[model samples]
Target: MTPVWKKTPKPTELIDRVTQAFRLAFGYEPTAVYSAPGRVNLLGEHIDYSGGTVLPFALPQRTYLAVTPRQDRLLRAVTAQGDAGASASSSPREIELGAIAPGAVEGWLAYVAGVPWAMAQEGLVSRDELPGADIAIDSSVPLGAGLSSSAALECSTALAFDAFAAANTGREPLSASDTGRTQLAIACIRAENEIAGANTGGMDQSISLRAHQGSVLAIDCRDFSTRPLTVDVDRAGLALLVMDTRAHHNLSDGQYAKRRAACDFTADTLGLTTLRDYFESTPTLAEAHQLVARWEEQVTAGMVDLPPQTDLPTARAALRHALTEIARVEECLALFSTAETTEQTWAQLGDLLNASHDSLRDDYRVSCDELDLAVNAARAAGALGARMTGGGFGGSAIALVSQELVPTVAEAVASAYERAGFNHPEFLLASPAASAAQDR
Candidate 1:
């Protein structure tokens, strides 16, 4: 595992630039800066929202915010990466407290405005009691790359505001007993979920909140609980490769909404509050199948009639596959804790990955030609196992390979993709990285 505290100049540069901008715009120096890291799901996909287990690690990429309170109820923001010359070059605008609403600001400013409005709505902060500040935002996370970039942005902003509020008012911060890091972390997560309209599980925020060096966090999204599992890959000369398909996928898209809706329907149909509730009391595959059957019947009857061309049987099979995949994720976590050798771990991990892809391809129907090609090419080129990693409708895939074969495997996949007339994909070698922390 790579050390979380690797000396990187990016954060230092971001802090300096933000401080300079804050001093120039607000005529005051920022006392503190906070940062939150984007995360990648190493195993579980679409499972967080399903109320299942997820294993996510913070990426080195992060969003940083430098803050200083103001005497007025005006909020001003400047971006490290400016928008067009107009928005980027323009001096920070003093946004009226009342005017900050959905669509109040365009582009990334929406997030800047939305954070304050959300906090106010939750009574965490009031417009009348707003902490006036000039905040400068900088991020290295790739936007729309299926990584949790939005979460990083929202969490960092929330933390900066929370820290400023606590300092200025001399009031104990939310979840802070004067200075409890754990409490502050929870507060940050709440700010993002309640204030930012993200309807997200706690995975991103928790990883951002409690990431450590040389470990991958296996998080239970249901209770916001985490257990750090050390990833010792170097002994085996293995590399975790993340391939960016460059295909677009949006969380707010209808496909995501539909999958969420299906999970909800599954809970309601089973007379349960959530899928987690249903899974806990039922242990056998037979019982699981029965539950899925009942839910499928309810869904089919209530929703649009299954199209004649559509295979309802396959659809039911897909739901069962998802349920099984959820169980497999739990098993995989156990394996991660006990597996002795890297190859042993890779084999177990790869089996699960292959199972997941089969489910996505046949059951969920979310895999695309490009995704399949990448997975196939990697596996054919000596990858132990590979699968599409995200909410897959054209996102990226991850492949498990030994270090010696990485170059050959990546090249083979790219070549296969090119020959198929698809755009060549960008491949990255990533490992379990540290989660978010306060930048001093």
Candidate 2:
């Protein structure tokens, strides 16, 4: 919709920086550089672990890695962070290949070390035959803003190591085939969950590996199936704006984990295995709604006993958001799959986005005041719709705006932040970008 971003810089820009950093840190030029893009979840938040639908788009911003194979069982990993990233508690160091276990590393380095640990566990590469790597990382994706920068780093790490594995095993280097990419994404998920201790569903890694330029991925979190639906918002005079609130979020902090656990508890209360089971087990949305409505009423009546880490109010809230968001996903996908898009179509989608924000704020209880202010300001400035994206507690928000209003709306948001005495948040203009680098 945005003319395929003719002036966007190639991954080569970051590749050059990562290569130089790799050389400086490891005393050798790395064999090759690989990168992966961060993503902004447009809708269907928090329902990922329920095996519900999630819509996400890749950002032009990305994380990059330059890797060299080591003959010995040692990995030298480092990152050249900007002044902003200097607060990271972990420093550059070498870790034994066998010692790359869960909780073996701390802070951001844990996410990096986790990928190879997952690869080995999955038998994608043999521990004995694996060539440990020296890697240097660099990223433009903003960290801890609910934008999925961790997935970007894990994906690039997977891509780089996959190539090294191919060379070691006499297999061809990693290709961009859908199946191969999906498997790699799962590996990345394992890294985040098992090693990095993020405990998330696989939506972030799936989007990182499966995103396409000018499209949004409608992912079925159950089986990791995805359909790339065209998001020609610009053709209808609309644009997608990511407003980074600069209020950091950490998924490992137990609240996110608590939400996932609550969803599971709701599913169990509904006599189903997962939240998406409503669609698979019931014949109609009305029937399913009736089922959860009973539980909701019970929850409201204080008849149900919720876990100590959660409460009846929280469980009721989780169930309400999950059922409604799943229906919204189906409706949004149906409209998006239409042959041609019009102004009316974009308007309907905008309404869905706004509804999504409301649910995330009130039902999911994840939106913070900073995120709320950004969305409200964007809408006040003529955005069609605005909503908090990602895991929500103090993160970023996305707005659907007409292209002509982008500058004016952006200015209004900054002015509001200034007037409120909050830091002027980082504004990112995003359409879709390609999922992975070109086939190697």
Candidate 3:
């Protein structure tokens, strides 16, 4: 049977594998093994940076870390073959932890080293205060699948090292600290930005660190606050089909930054700190759009300098995508809150998703041919709705379909990809990605 990256099989089959890899890499057993899940953004894309809201849930697919705390401050890292955080290899490779520094560690382990480096820089722990450890990793989360494999890898390493630090000094678990998950998420963001060199909007880190079991987190980018919403995905006999188009996206490229710059330019031109701020002040979308139009008039009249590196069209589209995606989150909530959600209700939810994709694809211009193909194929296979998720130059598209049609939709997508002569893609059903328990 295939091993899933979810919170199943109690002690975790991946942890067992990671433990064996740890022993094989070093010479003894690990201190503790920990894991963290990746996530799928159900609604809202590229909106988090504009201080808009997003709905996302952690996936069962996750990343893992097995570590042994050391009195000697030597950081030795190894990863199992086929691990999410490392290159595919026939044997493990080790990196000394002492060599780690911000903007230094590259490849898959940069994200791992970044956690401790970030924490130390923040003075949460001094450089010498951090104990050296032998760390080994294994994961089922597929890298570059637009499923937040980076966040999962970072969080798992963060929690593992945090727990180890606590054990050595006898302090409350990091989760019990007043700082809690938010602080961890921030640290992960720092690592991703400053270390991993991925300038992201923080939705991935927040959901991976803060999402609850069996729930989607509604995150307000305004203040990084989150609310858990229990989605009855199974109640409607529906499944979220994740289609990894294998069209990997490198968000560090100019495209992701270009879109973000446009959003920021729009907000600045409108005299607001963020697009969310403008919408918050305006009572309705029409009024906000009207106000934005006025601002564009000012720019055209040379009454104010237009924000740099963005045209009026791109700026307008960015703001529109941000506002509409936030609205979709509310629509999804209302649909799920009805007295009795039926298949038809799900179809309505699907329509909202379709509208979201149209906006992202047409207005935001994030969807590429492969992503469009995945969405079209899933819809052709009878998906209630389908859309591309993640940073979106190309990564993955998600489809909402009845549980029974999962295979059919998946097969259809695969066949379509083959017909297009693209690489064969991977697919999986949606499941809430939960954090691991201490005892379990």
Candidate 4:
């Protein structure tokens, strides 16, 4: 299957408008317009922050930006979807870009402003940097849907800026080597982490920059190394259906922060810097569980500090659960890459999905009533496997089903939800999609 990078509609429009705005503002059209996709974790929820492995595939949804260099130090940015006044017109909103410090702009603008600021800080751009030019940002990825929409925005902006720099330096057709897509991606991720203050891992930006269609990205968060597992999901007569709960998930929520704190405390208790270290040294669930149990003793005994009344048992359970879930993520990748028959692949995939949900629910303590209800309904309606997919407080769930049963499955789940006095959920039939890329 071709990755979703080619299918993003809003980014495509945004690219065109930004290119036009740059031409108007700088008297020269951009050499290239680029886009990067938001991703959905096929498996491995909360593991990214835990410094474990993650398997994320780029969605068809993405953010697009277009840009060009300028002769002056001002940066102008406009979004086709932003609050552009009648006078402002869909043209670029002129801003004194080089004058603003790292944390000058707040809210969504930080992602835009921070990119250039970070690049300047990294010495990638000199004081005489291509000043700044007009940029237009647009995206179709659902925000706060646990799909990495913010990553898409950050990456697209960074890519556009990098492309402009390369073009200005007389570098034609900016390649990965010339533009340093990896470095730019990391910069965007840091912008989110440091400037934006969201404690998310770099998985989104990494996948956005490095993912390939017909594959799953196996990311080792500790060192940022990656391997692309070529997965074939075509023969199973099955589709991965994503249902949006329409519930917003904030990464800075206390629950999320608490879990991360607990992981850190556990790692420290074991004389490790990250849970990844513990996993690497101890390869079995039993060994990991023993280590976590000891870590819990320290938290309970006040030897190790807890994150303000965090349940020791709950935290320990979460840590152990993360260990098992990481193992399953690896297994799912193997199954996807090597399964002989579609039925067998679906069966294996479904089992892993169900197992993953159980871990999230019982051990990780992230699942909610709404998510549980959806999973139950899908199972009752004959879904091969169904579970909440993301950070799980109120995002969406994925159901693996035979193509013939999709409608029945969706209706059953939606009806069950309505009967429980909830809003009718939106169900999307999704498949493994490709990573984001620039439009030709």
Candidate 5:
């Protein structure tokens, strides 16, 4: 078992390391550098594509991109972390900017090559007009943790390209304004979906580009509008502990795609634009149950078709998770706004977190044994609330605990993993941090 805790490197340290890697790889200094943080979804899971609102905050762990524009049309990329799994090739990968397209690049380089292509598709820039760059990638965000490390890579690359475009046209940096950040996020999402072949929703990219320090960003996937709620964990005497099960998950696996497809199928069967169209405002847990019941009634009445690929029970289960998770997100927002968090409020928040995990584990069917153990152990150790964050399956779970009990909760989870003969879980203390931006 490895160490129980791993610290995310500070900005200065990461910046310096990336700079050195850039120089060593390209044999010249990078003109500029940009960084984007991986994200943790505090609440609301697997409903973004269904147009549900989610609460996510940026992590201190980030991916950094260092670039120097090239006069020619060839784009080249390299990474400092050879086994980061960001790319298949440990050496630099190169492709003509004009040749970049969907499936043009494979493996990790697809993420690197897709940004310029997506920017062109979005009309933010033309592929022929885009400046090629020698790029270096470095990151502290743990791979396969469901912490949105892929988004961090896409977003950092997007910001770097955005800066390149601004400088080429003698315009102000597009990353400077909220609207511009939204555009950059859009480009990143397209790169992930069309180029990388990952069917991710906008939640990850939106939070990576738009999140603020000490606040969680509430995102409406329907419109991609955002509201930041201040979270003072220190003031509330709480610590947000993220425990990585060391059980890696790949979203490109059919698991994530199947869930998204089921949700889409359910919404289409109901004749609603999205499951969220069924709710004008946030629903109560009772109302969420009612919504599920309504779906069952409709199914029994033969109002919708159940394709062989998606059975009635699976559709209903998916809907149940989406509706209930939406409610949990709303509850969190209300709690954050009403007053400073006291012990009672913290407990209430914990209950919602627990319920969210249950829905994901039972109905959504995404929790693995490792995730369940991590959550159960943290709760037994006196965490206010514990749930698996991100896309579930096999990634990380977060526990809300009293600040003073952080060590105790971490040790308990480690002990449980040890007893189960599972990999020793790694831990991180999560705080709301700044969104993606230029580092230097």
Candidate 6:
């Protein structure tokens, strides 16, 4: 059987439903409703925290938060659930604004309450001036699918706080200017890292806040600077298909933290600020191989300081993946700089995607069995290239296929999963989507 396909909800309907839910939960009208898109990283994986560049575009599926500032410093929040087969509805939680802090809130609620705390702690707003809010969230972004669902929630909350700050403090809206959006993105990052305890990098928040329709954002992780590249695959008869493996993936778990630690250890031992710095110096695939060989020699000679639980091989693999992934992003950027793309241009891009997945699976050790199966199956079914696109313990894979072959590719993946006795996957055709903004 062909797997199920998900569709993006109409924005007006989503806004209306969430607004009604907000009125029922808080007994008042919301000041405004804001939304942010989840993102799919087209290329570059597991290299953001290493200060490497990445390319990602926004997903139409979004999280909508209807919020209103309260007169007093108390946060009341609720969410609509059970559509994805979880709880029917989340129990409303009330939190004192003063009590907001890192690790103070737990479960999914931290993603909401931590925004105000992060904004104040990061100096985006004053703690005394911060307003308490009542939020009701309804999202279509699949949770734990490696689709940046948590970032979507945090970014939408960030926009809500910015709107209130603009009204109360006489400051301009942060989402109105690129500079302001960057600041908002930083606050969201802090919320995820400190308040939510995810230990993730800034890619998801950056793309969610800074992306533009009909384009992908190329983010320089070192400075978080971005440039939009218009890659119109539809004109070339290609479609980007997202394959949700239905395998559980959670970044807040310790597994993600360990990988970040390994990357940091590799940087410290190599005497570089980050692996990206080294990539800048040695920017070719050949140079990356040579550098890895030299590092292996040093490890064997007992000249490198190895962390207790991390060995030379793991560190070497992590460094290699970061450096090579950076180079692939550079190549992809160069390809997009052309005035028009051809079949050959896409073939080259496809080659890079295939290589990226191989590196993540073999070198970074992130891809799981389900992810591997989906990617391989898609490629076998005439996909130009396919790769796992998220945090990768078990998440979604992306396939680049001709528009006409989409159904064929989807069926092939479904058959593969059934033969393996894995959960049937879901599918979506991802298009470039807008950044976070007030919907009402």
Indicate which candidate wins on lDDT: 6
* TM-scores, all models, native as reference: 0.82, 0.92, 0.90, 0.84, 0.96, 0.97
Candidate 4 residue lDDT tens string, 1-440: 11111133554465666566556655666656777787777777878766778887788777777665567777767664453111324455565766556456655666777777776677665555445766666666766666777788888777667666666675642226423666776777778766665767778888887787767788877777788765455455676777766566666556766777777766776677777676655245466667677767776688876544666667667887878777777677667555465666668778888988988999988887778887888888888888887667887788878788877778887787778876567766555565556774
Better of 1 and 6 by lDDT: 6
> At residue 110, what lDDT does model 3 achieve?
75
The better candidate by lDDT, 1 or 4, is 4
Q: lDDT by residue for model 5 over 256-287, one digit each (tens)?
A: 88888888877888788888887756667788
Off-target runs (Cα >4 Å) in candidate 1 are: 1-9, 17-29, 81-94, 101-106, 120-129, 171-199, 281-290, 294-318, 339-342, 421-423
What is the alpha-carbon lDDT for the whole of candidate 3?
0.76
Model 1 agreement with the true structure over 373-430: per-residue lDDT tens digits? 8889889999888888766777678887889988888888878877888765776666
Model 6, which residues run further than 4 Å from truth?
82-85, 280-282
Q: What tens-digit string does per-residue lDDT give for candidate 2 at 1-440?
A: 12111133456677787777887777777887778899999888888899888999898888888887888878878886632466422345778878988888777777778888898888777876577788888888888778898999899888877877887778865444788888888889999988888889989999998887888998988888888888777777788988888888888888888888878876776577778886754223465467567776776787665655676676666777888788777778878777798778888888988988898889888898889999999999999999999987887898999999987888787777787887668787887887756321
Rank ordering of all candidates by lDDT, starting from the highest: 6, 5, 2, 3, 4, 1
| Tens digit per residue, CA lDDT, model 6, 1-440 | 76789876799989998999898887889878999999999998988998888899999999999998888998988888532437536457889989988878887788888888888888888876778888899888988888999899999999988888888888788889999899989989988989889999999999999999989999999899999998888999999999999997988888888998887887788797877876546367777777778777888898777655977777778778878888888889889997799999999888999999999999989999999999999999999999999899998999999999999999999999999999999999999999998899
Model 2 residue 26 CA deviation in Å = 1.5
Identify the leading candidate in terms of TM-score: 6
Q: Under the 3 Å rule for N, CA and C atoms, how many clashes does model 1 have? A: 1
Candidates arranged by TM-score, highest first: 6, 5, 2, 3, 4, 1
lDDT of each: 0.67, 0.80, 0.76, 0.70, 0.87, 0.88
lDDT of 3 by residue, 194-308 (tens): 8887878889988887878888888888789887877778877898988888887877667877777777776776678877777554234465467567767887898766557
Error of 5 at 8 (Å): 2.2
TM-score of 4: 0.84
**Which prediction has more favorable lDDT, 3 or 6?**
6
Worst 10 residues of 2 by lDDT: 1-10
**Lowest summed-lDDT stretch of 10 residues in model 5?**
81-90
